[model samples]
Target: MIISRESGFRHDTKRRGQSMPKRHPVNQTHNALEDEDSCAVYTALLADQGSTRSELRTKARLPLPVFTAAMEQLHRLGLVERDPSADERLLALPPATAMIRTCGDDLRYLAEKQERVYRVTASLSPYSRVYREMPSSGGITASGKRLLNRAEVGETLRDLTAGARGEILTSLPTGESEELFTLTENALRRGVRLRALYRSSVQFNQSSARDTQRLIRLGAEVRLVEDGFTEIVVIDRSAAVLPLRDDAEGALVVQDPHVVHFIVNAYSRAWAEGSAFPVRYRRQQVLEASDRTKHVIMKLLAEGAEVPTIAKRLAISPRTCQRHISEIMNRLGARNRFHAGYLVGQRGLVD
Candidate 1:
């Protein structure tokens, strides 16, 4: 087995009977030098479009053997192209294409893929050994917080959830969580307790509402709360993830016992206050904001309030209140205020 330099995670280097070379494998592990060297080669390719072995070696300031190995690794990873008909020069893939195709839509899997690539080479470079020898910093500091930028969040968060053995809790935002659905599903399949909290608005969104309903059917306990929440992901009470702020461009990871407990407590309180995400919360379950306002007005009309009084109660202009009344009547196909009141009763919008 070869231990990953990033987090000391071990993956079997042996596959189908392959073995690590008898050389100083640690010294040959992939690290900073290879990264710098690859960048130099890529930059050169940008200029000439297709770089010869000699050209790349010169540009990267690497010897023949080192250049050869680096190019081989890059080629394997689909970062560069070598066409037989186009000679032996290296052609870099377009940046967007290379990134999306190689890393997919998320940056989480890059580390595992790199580990597999290095394992195939079977010998670590001196640069890699030096990186391994360096003391760890930033992750799990003495303060028990690990700070990561937006670029690092996906991978680190994925790693945290993947290690869950008992439970996973997530408070999702308004946006889609397509990437996390599979991860959560996997945890459930492993008999891990899965619970998720979402904004009440999500049940009104067709796509996400479907996703939550699907999750519920699959044994995930999904609930909804309305507003005043931040994104938090907790794994078995051992770790908690919080985005740095609303923008989600960075995150603060909490592994300290006190901090993790604090986050879990908040989650528990929210969970207690939330409503179950009804699989019955299908299409059009929630009315539009304006529509809900109309219903509110209907109740006021039902109670025999005049337009001026309704407008004051709702904090809208009387003209706006009259407009909403017209809209509500139009929607309910009512003849007048009395008929609209009758429709509201029929629809059961309010007691």
Candidate 2:
């Protein structure tokens, strides 16, 4: 006769069957094996019991052959019995109520220990050695992260320009824009040195009479260059603002010293070769001499006259000379003065 207890079974036979189930080696070994197999099957079932074969394949992250072999092994061991009432591929397990009850105290102990460890580690995190020595590169600094909205942008700019003692280098596509002029003037009044590069068109457009006059009166050093470079503003060789969006609504502020140095170097090179913004226009200008002012400008440019010198010889202000040159290149759809000259020569305008 076999009598069941809460923890184990008691058996009585004609022989000396007085031993407890816990002391029976054969029964203990079998129970241990079943427990081990049950744990594995339970975990897998919990992960994907109600899922389809395709879902199981994805969740298991195993190859098809390996997944099939695992399922077959589980079925043969009786750990996963088939669910005949449902789909043929579906399987189920007998309720593990008794086994789970036996391990409840041990599982609870482990869970409590894990929670304690997590709390202690989190409490000590700020003092960690790795965080203390964190390296700095190009990403946002702590201060920048705190100032993220439009309202704070002005404060950020003020802080950036506060102690800027060196020259600020900038390039403007539309130098005549009023906002840009105001910003430049503010920087100048703050005693910050200014070096600006403007597109050739802004130099000569008589339509922007007041803007040109104001720029000249401010005595802000200016230059005219022909290129597709967008607006670039570098402050004191330490920071730069480069527009990320087409309309200049978004910008990436670069605080990396190396990047700012590279940008400043490029700006200096362009400035060194660029013409200065002239104060006033003269009567006998190179631009006024020919009906095809663009062709004449390209011919002179190809002859290797510096932009400032060309402006002087042409009798117009240097800005006006640059504007004429820019127009010629655009009409010919040329990349630079040299290219414009080539196209003009092709048309027999210049030898």
Candidate 3:
């Protein structure tokens, strides 16, 4: 059948012959047929078609009995078939489906074992413990257990102010009185770095202008931004306090690091993007003079004062009064008296 010599079929058959014992023909025959060498020879011979028994024996270099034993094993293993098309003298290879089926079974067994191991590991993980103990509510209360009153909150703030070596971030809005202003000034006089943000509209008032100037001289930074809410105060990076209500009675003292860090970041972003309060104050002061003059001229014009009457009342010439009215219309960006009054009201220039 043109079987290659390198297949080791011939050597295996010969080894079985040399190991056989005499006077035990039946036992020797069964043992030789069941041996590993016999199985190797059987597998090799099945791979070679059209091979005669004599030819197989000659190639395998084995005696008749050993060769017959190997051929019988090949028949038992179902690796060879008697080829009826060739006078039943030759052996044929088994179909490839059997070998592939065995390999697929082994792969499926390994995959099942791996899945079982993964399921067991996941069930025993530490995250499973956390999941079992979730939704807990026995920690600190909203009003802290240690500090229960305003007096305690004040003491804590005083300690924070004393320990504040660098800078402070605060938003102080003037309301019924200037209590916050006094507290801010006290901090400023202590040489503590202060960065303050106030509402833009009130920032130009006479009292606010003087207070802002004092803060600037004390090395405090100030800005004005569009206001929506009350105030936010962050002292150093260690602590933060926000009023729980708009009336500024009770405060929420934040000691959690993550929450305080987020508050500080929000304040820093607002400060950087905000307008300069001092510059807005200066512009308002400069514009007030022209605004007052425009108001006087508008009143006289409404009262039907002649040009000479207006000039005498304003202590200016008739031509100068007319020029002033023209300048006021241009400055107000108004087309008529109604539009001028609207613009003035919109600008919040009137008392």
Instruction: Report the C-alpha lDDT of model 3 over 1-351, residue by residue, as the tens digit.
Output: 234578735322134343312221123346643576566565556566677777777767667887787777655544566578887567655546433333455556557667978999898887656643442532234543234346655766666666776677787554212544555567778777788876554453577677777777777788765432246667777677776553344466677788888888888887886666554435655476445556767665555556686655544457766776777678888786556556666676545
Writing each residue's lDDT as its tens digit, candidate 1 over 1-351 gives: 777899899877576775543431122367897877777777777777777777777777877877877776676456788755678866788867765665563454445567878886666676555553443654444544545465577787678778899999898855237777877877778888888887665665688877777777778998776542568888999988787644456677777889889888888999998777766633455454455567668888888788887765554568878898998889889999778888788788776
Compare candidates 1 and 3 on lDDT and give the better one. 1
Query: Which candidate ranks first by lDDT, i.e. highest?
Result: 1
Which candidate has the top score in TM-score? 1
- Between candidates 2 and 3, name the one with more favorable TM-score: 2
Give candidate 3 misplaced runs (Cα > 4 Å).
1-153, 175-183, 228-230, 279-351
In order, the Cα lDDT scores of the candidates are 0.72, 0.60, 0.61
Error of 2 at 38 (Å): 60
By TM-score rank, best first, the candidates go 1, 2, 3
- For candidate 2, the TM-score is 0.41
Q: Residue 253: error of model 1 in Å?
A: 0.9
Per-residue lDDT of 191-271 in model 2, one digit per residue for the tens?
778788775545556655457566556666777654424577777898886664433334567777777778888888888
